[model samples]
Target: MKISPLRSVRVTRYVTPLREGGSLPAIVEADDGFLYVQKFRGAGQGPKALIAELIGGELARFLGLRIPEIVFSDLDPALSRLEPDEEIQDLLRASGGLNLGVHYLSGSSTFDPVVNDVDALTASRVVWLDCLITNVDRTARNTNLLIWNRELWLIDHGASLYFHHSWENWEEQSVRPFAQVKDHVLLPYASRLEEVDAEYRALLTPEVFRELADLVPDEWLDDPASQRDVYAKFLTSRLAHSSVFVNAALYARNALV
Candidate 1:
């Protein structure tokens, strides 16, 4: 939970852009010989993106996916500081990193969707996980899925877990009910749903949740009353509907029989 200060990091001469989203993501090699650096473009939406990165990455790991190492980075904003909007700067400063480092993934790119698409089985599980976390990022258009080195890798969690009360709900909305997720992409992986739920429930301990909450900057949690109110609502909603999600996912996995 406690991340040490990064004294230094190595970068390879070779670095390339990975996507065309609001954030200009790239893959680069680190001094540690690690490939891929998912840098934050200060110009991108701002605090929300950073929170998305944290929540999505954490949940992905909790779901037992093979995610890469993620760390908070400090970058010189001038290199790619966020937009010049005053409101945006406040969000950028609140977020520890708006420039500097990049996210690391293993491969170059996935060439074929049919052959390279993440297996339906895995995708199904991913979908269910997304649903439980109330993520809205994974769409047919921006799957944010990459197939590198002949394996499926998920990136750009910045859009998921939107239901998280990490920041003011600029969109101010309630989480969608779990029972309503039958149409989710992970519907196909429903067969493994219950198991996934058990795994998820196990991971949402108070300590872990608090640690995650801590990682989020205080500025983001400025509206203490709204934040607490929203957190309670979101958490309660998740637990209340968790059974449906669990049962449906398990039934898909045949755990119900």
Candidate 2:
């Protein structure tokens, strides 16, 4: 299946800083008259976080998971001048180019694992996706999930695909089992991992990875050593060794329960 490119928009207004995470993402209004949770390119993690957000979110969507619509939002350096906060001013100046935005879910609340009960299928899928991407932020502490319109939605994938932080050993990292699965928020409920694994594996192909990689903006992959193809190659290699992480999750879940 061919994936469509993300929508592009210009930031019309900066609403407020989220302040929850170190990156200082904010809610901003785009030219399209919609609010988006904008992930700035100039944040502490730099563009790699946005790249991870794009690839991880799109990959989950491709696997039939619910993800907020991701968009390419252009930030104007002039917008920073209007802000009184020197910190935000610096952020806007640094993120003057293309940034990432997630369609805001107006009244969504963070997922509270204790207060909410997820079905086996949804839990399995979430766990499986996290494993496939080596996402480490979905622990009990910070689920990075939301309940919007009475449905579970995944967001904030910047912490996934962390191997890119140090590309020197990306090949080995691709196939490594994610031991972090033991701390996963949904691990206890992911009883259907074996079943979901078989299904999701068939959905993720090399072509699919390439298509997702293509969605990433050329500007985000500006690192001299990291090209767009590298993203595709990393995921494709990881998928080939899916069983390694799949088994790791299964083991963690068993130990947990």
Candidate 3:
């Protein structure tokens, strides 16, 4: 699939801080007159987290999953001056540049595993996508899912693609099974893994991976072109050996059932 470049918007107002996670993402108003959940480049996880969020979220979207629109948000240093909190002020100052934002979903509630019921097909697709990306989040404790307009929406994928955190032995990491699948919130409902696996594997081609890699911004990477190549290589290699993780998720689901 040919993906268009992300829309760029400048942050016009420094809204309230979302203190849910350690990274301190905020609901900021953009120049386009839209509120966004802005993930900062200056956060503890740094630019790498934004990169993972972009790649993982877009990949989910490409695979027919619901993800809030991701965009390139420009932060201005002057926007921090009105903030009383020293820490937030520091964060705003540090994040002055290109950051990541997700279009804020108004009135959306967090997906509670105990309260929500997901269909086997949806569950299976989510499980498969998480396994493919080696996402460490999405456990029962924090699903990172939202129920907006009564539809499940995936979010906060900064915890995915962790192999990039330490590039050593990244090739080996690519083919490994995701043991965390056992703790996945959707595993119990994912009865159609085999079916979803077949469909997703076919949908995500080498070209798709390349396109996803190309979507990442150059400023985020040390070696823009080469690192993009590395990301594509890692993802394509993981896709090539998807069965390793697929079987792992199947075993986990079977155990849950």
Candidate 4:
């Protein structure tokens, strides 16, 4: 259950924006001489998006899934001075503090289910994780998966854990069935939902939930530590209601049977 703490890096140079989404994620070079897909804390989605990315990415690693390395990236406010684009400059100015960095995958291709084949177990686990976290963004149109070195890797988890948007009554919604699971891109390939439930469920212990939740930076959250406790409680509740999500996924995939 033990894992290394997230590494921190300073952005050395500004790169092109991905521009595919509203958050305006960018490809940047860091002090470590590595490229990172930077999620700005100043983006319209706010720090909560980065928080979701950290929590979801770490939890995936704990479950032995292939996720890009996440880091607490430092963005220098003065870097904005070099950007001529007013839009990006504003972004840099707003996000002059801590941002989220996803290790850039070089020579990777977007995963298109139409032409690619994914094994059942891998597909099932991915689908189950999405459902468990109430991540509704991994649909056919936006798989949020990449094929790097001929291996499937998950990315863009900023939309998961939607309940965190409203800390008010978040606990009550934690146990609710993750309905968007029906539209999951992998559901058709995930034929072993029940098996996935039995095997993967236990891996996410209460301790793991708390541990992963604690990974979020204190500054990003309004009440800092209180948010971590809330996240832990919500995740632990979701784990306890694992069956509800598992069954819902199975029922949604029943069309294949």
Please name the candidate that would achieve the greatest lDDT relative to the true structure: 3
TM-score comparison, 1 vs 3, better candidate: 3
- Model 4, range 78-129, lDDT digits (tens) per residue? 9999989999999999998899999999999999999878999999999989
How much RMSD separates candidate 2 from the native structure? 1.2
Model 3 TM-score?
0.98
lDDT of 2: 0.91
Clashing pairs in 4: none
Estimate candidate 4's alpha-carbon lDDT, on a 0 to 1 scale: 0.89
Residues 20-40 of candidate 2 have per-residue lDDT tens digits of 999999999999999999999
Model 4 residue 95 CA deviation in Å: 0.3
Every candidate's lDDT: 0.53, 0.91, 0.92, 0.89
lDDT rank order: 3, 2, 4, 1
Which one wins by TM-score: 1 or 4?
Answer: 4
| TM per prediction | 0.65, 0.97, 0.98, 0.98
User: Which stretches of candidate 2 lie above 4 Å from their native place?
Assistant: 223-226
- Tens digits of per-residue lDDT for model 3 on 59-133? 999888999999999999888899999999999999999999999999999999889889999999999999988
Checking candidate 3 for backbone clashes, the offending pairs are none
Q: Best-fitting candidate, measured by TM-score?
A: 3
